[model samples]
Target: MDVTVVGAGPVGLVLAAELALSGAAVQVLERRADPDEAMKAQSINVPTAEALDRRGLLPAAEQVQRELLERVGSFAGAADDRPPGAGRPAPERRFTGHFAGMVLSPDLVDWSDPDLAAHAAVDGARMVPQPQLEALLADHIARLGVPVRRGVEVTALEDTGDGVRVDTTAGTVRTGWLVGCDGGHSTVRRLAGIDFPGTDPELTGYQAVVDIADPEKLAGGWTWSTRGAYRYGPQPGRVATLEFDGPPAGLPHARLRSRGGTPMAPVTLEEVQTSLRRISGADVTLTALRAAPTRWTDNTRQAAAYRSGRVLLAGDAAHVHPPFGGQGLNLGVGDAMNLGWKLGAVVAGWAPEGLLDTYDAERRPLGAWVLDWTRAQIGVLRGDAKSAALREVVADLLSTRDGTTYAVKKISGVTQRIDLPGDHPLVGRFVPDVWLRDGSRLVDHGHDGGFLLLDRTPDGAFARLAAAWAGRVSSVSDDHATPTGVLVRPDGVVAWASDTTDIAAITGLEAALHRWTGAQTSSPAHEPVS
Candidate 1:
């Protein structure tokens, strides 16, 4: 196999699909016996939605997700106490994410800015369950003929000079590269000998579905106490409680063991009762426990290095943080996107030196930023008087126009800029999903997983030069835009753009192509004259 991807979750499936689409032989190994029905994160941020749309999977995702949205009423993160239709038609309904306990609302952002909307690309959020996302990706990879094998646990890995030898429960397999997308406790990450370093848990969080004897006594929103914070509903029968008292002593783990669970135990109704009693001094009784309660912590850590020889890491295997703002899946998806095409290029023998290294260079900083973003929130949500004051101030700031826009940009990842070599402001930015005169979109041209050239010059020289790269690059005639042409990479980043598609512009485009995709053999008919 060209690539052996461990963990058939969204990240691994995405990488596999990209590699397979690019003509690489890929296989995915998963430890899970089957798909999980438990709904984990339901919030999909704008950037992740846009990434899916770029790959032509968003339509399918939306087809399933739209029904969920309509059924659930899609009012997550909106003001609960709105004065009955106060705002102007709700401005396309961007979902609310939070920095800490403070909610980051769509209403806070100015969606009218053309540049912001252009950067948004797909222009919405998705609220799909974890299983749905995994299923969607699984179906996509299946369509692409990428095989995903389940009930296979990778126990060990050895990176030979030329390839990686993976030893699983089933058997040993040799592959050119390996990627670990397994969850926070990643077996592949441990086997590859990567050091995971970061802060420890500050608090313990509990969540469960229960039958409350007195549901009316419990507030239906987030509440802060001396011990910690908790949120009761938006979901009836579901309760989430947090405690900053300390790490679990033994009760939580013991309950999990009694129920035949693992060390990172599932919370019990008794545990929830104890936590709530201690934190809120509430004597609310439970009629029945419908589901097993689960325990988590704000335990944060990230791998010291994403790559070690031919073995790499993505998703929770690379970084793990508190589930603040629904960033884990989104961050992982971004990692897969950044690494997939680069890996495909390397395997296809067109990648320049140091191309793969950019994965760590680009993604590591973003991971660190996310870690700090969550940490900042954790600090203010500390359930203290000082922290409460700080939260109030920060919440007020987040409600301001500039503050809201800044938060939106950071959370949505729309303003994310890379530092590629170019004087054009959009050089390191994602290329807009520019609509052409032909009734097609710029994103449509990227479906083949190739670089796109939007040529609108009087002479067709730029288009001819683009043809020199053939399968590595594609061109579309856009007799519309201001710049003579725009060069977009397979990942939808603007590699080069010019005011005019002259001889000079063609020379620059070729150089840019060489910089991004390496040198291609030129034919006499397409080669530019110096």
Candidate 2:
């Protein structure tokens, strides 16, 4: 096999699909016998939504989001009976999500900001639940003829220079590459001897749906206390709480979910009710517990490195942080999208020496950023006097136009830019969703999972230049397109761009194709685009 992907979660499935799209032989192995239907992520960031659109899964995601918005169930901050997106202003003017527990105001965001507006497209973010997204990807994988072997756990890995030997519960398999998309307690990462070190937990959090004898006794939405934070319903029987006292003395880690996994220990009526009373000081009583209660902590950590020879890590295996702002699922999805095509290039034998290493270089810093993002929220939610004061400051900042726009930009991931070598302003940034002259959009060509060149020159000079890297890139052109050329990577990042398709600009395009696609060319110099 070309690649053996561990863990059948969204990240693994996405990576597998992208590999298949890139013509790489890939298979997935998951430990769980069945899919986990627990309450996990409730939304996909803008880039994640665009990623789905790239794979033609956007329609299904939209359908699922409509269904999820119909009923606000266990998920906190879920939309009410109004509908998924009914009567909202322009997508840019809306409040992103929350910062800590404080909700951002829609009117406070500066919709006029060019940086934020540059990334918005016809499709904003979507509210598709994690389980729905997995089902969607599962169907996509079936169409692609990729096998996702569930109930098979990774026990060990042996790197034999050219390939990896993966020992699983069912049997052993050898592949040119092995990727761990497994959750936080990743066995592949553990067996690879990769260092996962970071800050410890400061509080224990709980989420569950139960029959409360007196539902009105507890406050609605997110309520905070000096002890910690708790959320008690926009929906009946839904309750979540966190305590600064940390997990119970010795309760086997009291974990119920790992970014995307099944429950570990059922939150009993006694355990949940006591936790509620301790934090809420309410005389609330629980009669029955519905679904398994989930416990998570701010136990943050990241892998020392993303790659160890032929063995690699992505998603939760690469990093773990508090599920604040629903960043975990989006972060993992971004990992799959970023690593999929790059790794495919490696397995296809056309990859440059340091191509695969770019995955580690580009994604690790984003993982670090997400960890601190969650840490910032925890700092505001610490529930101490210090926390209260900090909350006031952040809340004040969130009320301003620039502050709200910045938060929205960060949360939506619309303006995410990687540090790459290029002089063009758009280089290293996620390509803006520009409209093509043929009445199609740049995203229309993204579904093929190949490099894209959007060139607009009467003589089609740039398209001819990109033709040198045939099979690896496809070009789109028409007279109606603007007088600019853009080279987009498979992950939707702008690799190169030029304002004029002159002789000098053609030389630059040829060099970019060589640098990014590893295709040898005779182009000697690259002139920076003005």
Measured on C-alpha atoms, candidate 2 has an lDDT of 0.79
lDDT of 1 at 39: 30
Clashing pairs in 1: 267-293
Tell me the tens digit of each residue's lDDT in model 1 across 256-331: 1121112354456788877766766688887666665656667778899999999999988898777766787788
What do the candidate models score in CA lDDT, each in turn? Answer: 0.75, 0.79
Q: How many residue pairs clash in each candidate?
A: 1, 0
TM-score leader: 2
Q: Give each model a TM-score.
A: 0.89, 0.91
Single out the weakest 10-residue window by summed lDDT for candidate 2.
520-529
